[model samples]
Target: MQIILNGAATEVADALTMAELIEQLKLGGRRLAVEVNAELVPRSRFSEHRLAPQDQVEIIHAVGGG
Candidate 1:
């Protein structure tokens, strides 16, 4: 399946869940925010949030600043 990830077109496996994508990105231990098709997806729901083809996904990582 194809998806728009962080403003770029990318292909992912069929029936891939948000949690799996996060693991694939190697961000399992990082603080981040995810938005799908302009809708925010809570972290608690990542495991159940399945990604669809052509879905627009935005992943923003949190950075600590002084």
Candidate 2:
């Protein structure tokens, strides 16, 4: 399957969930925010939010520095 990740075309496995995607990207356990097709996906729902082909995904990591 193909999805637009952070504005770039990328290939992923079929029936991939948000949580799995995070792990695949080596981003698990990090503080971040995820938006799919312009809709925000809460962390609690990452495991349940399944991504489909051509889905627009935006992943933003939180950085704390002052």
Candidate 3:
């Protein structure tokens, strides 16, 4: 499956849910928002929602600045 992550195009295995991607990418507790194909993927739904091919994923990690 091909997906454009952030801005780069990459290929990943299919049947992957948002939560699985997070773990696969080793993204833990980043305190960010996840958007898949123009739709916001709620944290609670990440585990259940399956990502499709060519889906656009934008994960914005929260940054602390003063």
Show model 3 residue runs off by greater than 4 Å: none
Error of 3 at 9 (Å): 1.1
lDDT for every model? 0.97, 0.98, 0.88
In order of appearance, the predictions have TM-scores of 0.97, 0.97, 0.89
lDDT of 1: 0.97
User: For residue 63, what is the lDDT in candidate 1?
Assistant: 100
Tens-digit lDDT track of model 2 for 1-44: 99999999999999999999999999998999999999999999
- What is candidate 1's lDDT per residue for 1-66, written digit by digit as tens? 999999999999998999999999999989999999999999999999999999999999999999
Worst 10 residues of 1 by lDDT: 24-33
Q: In model 2, where is the ten-residue run with the lowest total lDDT? A: 25-34
- What's the candidate order when arranged by decreasing TM-score? 2, 1, 3
Give the per-residue lDDT digits (tens) of candidate 3, residues 1-66.
988899889788898888888988899777879999889988999999888888999999988999
Model 1, which residues run further than 4 Å from truth? none
Where is model 2 more than 4 Å wrong at Cα?
A: none
Instruction: State the TM-score for model 2.
Output: 0.97
Q: What's the true lDDT of residue 45 in model 3? A: 94
